[model samples]
Target: MGKIIIYEHANFRGVSREITSDISNLGRLDFNDIISSVKVIGQPWVAYEHINYSGRLMVLEEGEHNYVGRSMNDTISSLQMITEDLHNPQITLYEHPNYQGKSRVIREATNLAAGFDNDIMSSHKVQRGAWLLCEHSDGSGIQYIAREKDNLPHYSAIYLNDKLSFLRPLRPGQQLCPGGIALSSPQPCSWHPGCHPAPRGRNSNSRSPAEMGRIILYEHTNFQGLSKEFTSDIANLRDADWNDLASSAKVIGQPWVLYEHSNYGGRFLVLEEGDHSFFGTKLNNKISSLQMITEDLSNPEITLYEHANYQGKSRVVREATNLAAGHDNDIMTSHKVQRGVWLLCEHSDGSGIQYLARERENLPNYKAINFNDKLSFLRPLRAGRSY
Candidate 1:
């Protein structure tokens, strides 16, 4: 009896015990070589290396796929730990760079260059690169990217010579690249684009989240792509989402907002003025309902008043004959006068807000209008009707 060795990437499983016919032709074959040979052998089973979909590689295995040589499980661990469970454990070998530390998020070698190409040449932050099995599910995302240096993509990607290693949805018994080739960085299994690492970069800590143009919040945000900003739940998580995150922000999670921003430790003009969150954090200029608005109200500043129904400003100016009258009349009035009526109306009404008459006479002519209403209305003296 002799020992058996199985190089699945090739169609050879029991080379020693079953391969007494082909030793003369075979010399040396690496993982890539093995996978390529299987494709040429025209066998029932084969290995695929090129990426299939957006970026995935597939590995296939048949029944009792490989019952040959004694295989080692942990290639990185020098212990040469072997697992012969015979259960036919499915294993995909990994090839990564030497360095096992954090590296700059942005690089030409990164896969993001395809769609996540912000194209930043260099920065101050310090980081490194390497490869890993991405084994533990807990090790999902690119973690703790320095203060501002976190927003980046972290999927089953590898960057080499500025090229991204796209996969074809790997499967069982598939051949894997030699070293650890990564899209970039050491991210938590949760790391993704536009999610937790949206704003993080090499110059992270020194800059503000606003400066980074994005924000990544929470332990792991489940997303992909580089949006304008980054924040937790910015995309409004919904059903039907993508499984991985990387170079480009994906709408798989829902709403597909790809980017977001938080108040950071201070206040900013996100939605509007006065509207603020804890720590005086204000909304930026997202401008939807006036509710999210918290703007800087300067003294005697021109501000826009909004109604639950209306969009733009909800108020205007009007004048009265008495000159120093209070609010304007809540009447559908024209820009003219009947009896000593000029400069009327200075406030708003329920139906419509006041507007400057453009006619210039100041006094307005009452048209379609009633008195008090829900939103409340201030009526000035009528043409002939007193007060």
Candidate 2:
């Protein structure tokens, strides 16, 4: 059990309340919306804006909050102990672009209106957790979900599409589902296979857990509109009235390849174990067939070669990095992204012209951008967070 002390005044003075367990509604103890300072011991806690833990949140670690700060003073309505495998509170909000100007480092969910009521956030740094940057106060209005490792240079290109007014850090694996179709059942499988359930006795009503990978195709970007789930390769999507109309896709179990022509022929893009909002450029709305990639390419990788069809000096990338440090001047004539979407850039730091690659196979040249050896940098394509 964890213990937390809340004070009515700063520096731990005034009438206070001590909590050892989760309190969904602090109002029962006459402690609603009147917190100024806090001291936590042994466990982390999450405070909410309104009673019953149903408002903007702030995760507090074991420490002393001498002053709850302006954004959250006298505004905490409820709080609860956090037992999930959450990360330590470490998020920084900025008032200007590129992490410039005034800023606030938040270790808990916060309603900007409470403390920084007049602040307009233009950038942020999320060290962990999937955070939602809400446009309006108290976690409402247009919002953008920023995952771990996301370093957005501009907020104008994402959800809310402008300054952030409020922020909330979500527990790991949390899906915001913003304006997108919600899957009835989200699979446990991902790019890295481990926790997947083993095959058990067959129960005629259900397929074996071994075939748990379910691929969903959508007619619009970000998993919107009509969708169909499949556990097997579809050589012909026309049979299901879904030919050449796929604009987005979400994958589970293993990664799958989407073919532009039926029978797994013609150009194809690989949809890995994540969501693909937009195919980008010529790859969008041109899928005719798809099939699960059984070959276990356990690691997400992209290999760039100086020669066509896997030849010459090659550089394999598994994480986002500046290629200019080592291979800046090398000519990349061919490339292969085995399990994740990658953006090939003409310059380092992903600022120059780029191309999004989501599938496997050798590209003799980047004909889309009309360049071959021009790629000087590369990074993984992230869903819902990429500009």
Candidate 3:
């Protein structure tokens, strides 16, 4: 919590009020647009010119102000505290995606064109005001508006992987896309931002050839633990000491088609370029064979069934968080998606282990993706306004 002392006079004289919480309308308290001076203690705050935090905006840091400044003087009507480390205005940068590996914090607006050029920087979390990130050193290439508390998982999909080189804070009057979350990281501008940099290996391989084509499978979520890459079709995962042990995957180049049995038999599914956390039941640790397929870019869609092999009750979905409130744990088997991508979960609200479904057909058994008649939820690719 924080406290703000608003004075009706410019030099802290006359009627005054101290606020420690959100006030949508100050008029009710007889302090509407009378603010002339201010003093803030603890967290930062944003004061709006009109009621309900609308109209002009003002960012007040933790300090004493004899006057409210030219832009916000006597125009403040409503205010809300922004929870952050007020002592310092900085952003944390992670070396690897998903807030992994080494890390560093940037306090002032800086450029990474020299020593740090096109290196590290996989994920980030803003601790202050809005930040403008650019791919080029001089602020050219790709640009993204990062607001406070933004958590970027990965930059691969946005063509920003190891591509960010500059950053600066966004000034007043500027605005960002609004809907759900207030922050977003280097997400792709569109579905097709050209072929992304060759697949990057999390552990085993450090290879990214010009024409590289490989898919890496992780034994754990968040791309941790042991991992292996595949470039050609494998008749059996056991042949390489890796059978029924794939929990996550990162695709590159062409798409990969997986199977539940050796010799490309049993239940089969396709996967494009991206990262997957949960592989689900039968396919989780039961993958037996896989073959690469040509890349395809199109809208994704999926259908869920009450029984395996496209049987019984079924539902089609094209977006995220398809609630299975009444039908929780009522899914089994499947016919798979014909276009785009999706993640099948064992719990409702798209939580728990997520099973990837990409152009797969006839999953007579839910054993491959895990749970049998226990599917609770699903979500389409690219969450919110951006991926």
Indicate which candidate wins on TM-score.
2
The ten-residue window of minimal lDDT in model 2 covers 175-184
**TM-score (all chains, Cα) for each model:** 0.19, 0.33, 0.29
On lDDT, the stronger of 1 and 2 is 2
Total backbone collisions, model 1: 87
Q: lDDT for every model?
A: 0.23, 0.68, 0.67
lDDT of 1 by residue, 21-57 (tens): 1121122222221321111111112122222111222
Model 3 misplacement above 4 A: 86-105, 109-148, 151-387
Model 2, TM vs. native? 0.33
lDDT of 2 by residue, 252-299 (tens): 667677887889887667566677898876768778788775543444
| Model 3 TM-score, 2 decimals | 0.29
- lDDT per residue for candidate 3 within 1-387, as digits (tens), equals 457889998989999888978999999889988898888765566788899977666666666788887777878889876654334457887878998987777765455643333456888888776666778755666666557888888877566778887765543321112321112224432444442333334865444463356788876677865567888878777655456656778887666778888798776555666787767665776677777653232466777677767788877767665456655355556646766556677677555655666665446678676767677777554411111
Report lDDT (Cα) of residue 268, candidate 2.
Answer: 65
TM-score sort, best first:
2, 3, 1
Pairwise TM-score winner, candidates 1 and 2? 2
